[model samples]
Target: MNQTAPATLRSRLWWPSAAALTIAAAALGATLLLPRLFSDPVGVDPYVLRLTGVAIALAFVALVWSRFATVRPILLAVAAMTAAFSVFAGGPQWIENISGSRFDFNTQVLFASAAEALLTAVVAVLAVRTSPSTLRPLLRLRRFGPTALIATIVGVAVFVAVVMLLPATLLGREGIAPVALARDLPLQGPASVLQSFAQELQFRGLILGALDRVAPPWAANLGQAAFFGLAHIAVVYQGPGAAFVPVTIVLGFVLGWVTQRTGSLWPAIVIHAVADIAVTVGVIPGLYGY
Candidate 1:
């Protein structure tokens, strides 16, 4: 009877799990491949683009159809769409093209804010349509006590230290300008908060929770961290070297860990926001400015 029950459960879960993985792979592939095929020298035909769009629309409908039945497929769709938009819409090349007067801060914030808003809306809709009960734990703040707050503070401090130390240790210099940082703090601080909130919502709340349905908790945590890290490739075009990738991946791991441990996304959001604010304020007197 025990063996039969186990086998029965696997049979019930197998198809949904397979469907989730298939949709995720398809969405990711379309996001990456479609843009290349449509851009520059390899420009795809308009008819091809239209057909691709139709296909994606149909896929989206299928995802929605399954959302109330299972969370993983919709979760995969949302995560892939978020990453794709972040890369193709406001990526470094797009930023460079649109940047005119306030190239550094304002342009980046505007684009990032728009992308984050869109992703947040999508996640919100999915949460409402799918299973609010599944997401309640991620949204609840009962676990966000003194312990979590202290951990967030410590995490932000470590992040600041790393940002300060990396440039000197790896590149032989430090970037710091107190006066300029102070002057820009008014703008950068709120922008940092918005950016952090958006990321935490998508990654910790949506992606992590979704992955949990399909895999073991630890595997889900690591998988989301990897996705978060890869999404930062756009940063390479903005500046910094390949090292940024690993650093962000590690950061993602830490943030994901805290989110899972706390049973809430608030701690991770606070840590991320504070870390960005510290980076903007030149907290450690470093050469690698935010």
Candidate 2:
């Protein structure tokens, strides 16, 4: 009876899990592949150069589709995730519009990152309010112990070490300015931290949390990581940084594993923040993030 029951459960779940994974892959393709194929790709709005329309459509499907009811929360979470992400990507435009002038680069990062985190928070809370109780355990914000602490220390050290050890040529840096970083770190540091937190909460906390409940652990981790990695393809769309996408995929998988192992979100957030800070400080893009 036990063996038969397990088989039956897998039979019921296989299709919905596969469908959710397909949605993630489509989201990635839309962001990474379609843009380069078309010169002037349309967007949900002036801000979201991509993804929101498809996200909303998927959300509608999740609302109506009774077939994939087993993984409905995961679908909704992904859909809401892309919608919120669009809001984040468009944050700079709205901020500039509201302020009537481009603020200092660090200041811009500060505000935009904060706004993104805020909007994602609202989306996350709402998802929780509506989702099944099973979803609650996956968004582990409370766990912090010896294991999490040690993981964070090791993770951060690795990030700093790799960036510092890499040659300037490989890092794509022209020069380093200690004075400029000293001036900017005060603001940029927090900005990067907030930005990382926003991303971790969205990809790891909200989306991964939703998936972890309904899917196998490894499958859940990969789904979220693939989406996270593909989202960064915009960075390489115009540049020769296409190789960077695979690196991000590996990093995403590692962070997902860390989150699962430690049962805490802090380790992932801090590690991600270290990477963000490295990018900001690595090249010293003078005055603003140019």
Deviation in angstroms for 260 in model 1?
A: 1.1
RMSD in Å for model 2? 4.1
Candidate 1 segments exceeding 4 Å error: 1-26, 33-59, 71-122, 132-137, 140-143, 167-176, 234-239, 278-290
TM-score of each: 0.66, 0.83
lDDT by residue (tens digit), candidate 1, 8-47: 5434544564455456545544554466665643323422
| Model 2 C-alpha lDDT per residue in residues 1-290, reported as the tens digit of each score | 11112445655665565687676557746664555466645423342445656666666676577555555556656655566566666666677788867586567767777876777677667667665454342667878999999999999999888888877766656556678879889998997887787788878987677666656779878988987886676422224556667878889889999998998999999999988787677743522334
Q: What is the C-alpha lDDT of each candidate?
A: 0.57, 0.70
Q: Candidate 1 at 271: error in angstroms?
A: 1.7
In model 1, what are the clashing residue pairs, if there are any? 174-287, 175-286, 175-287
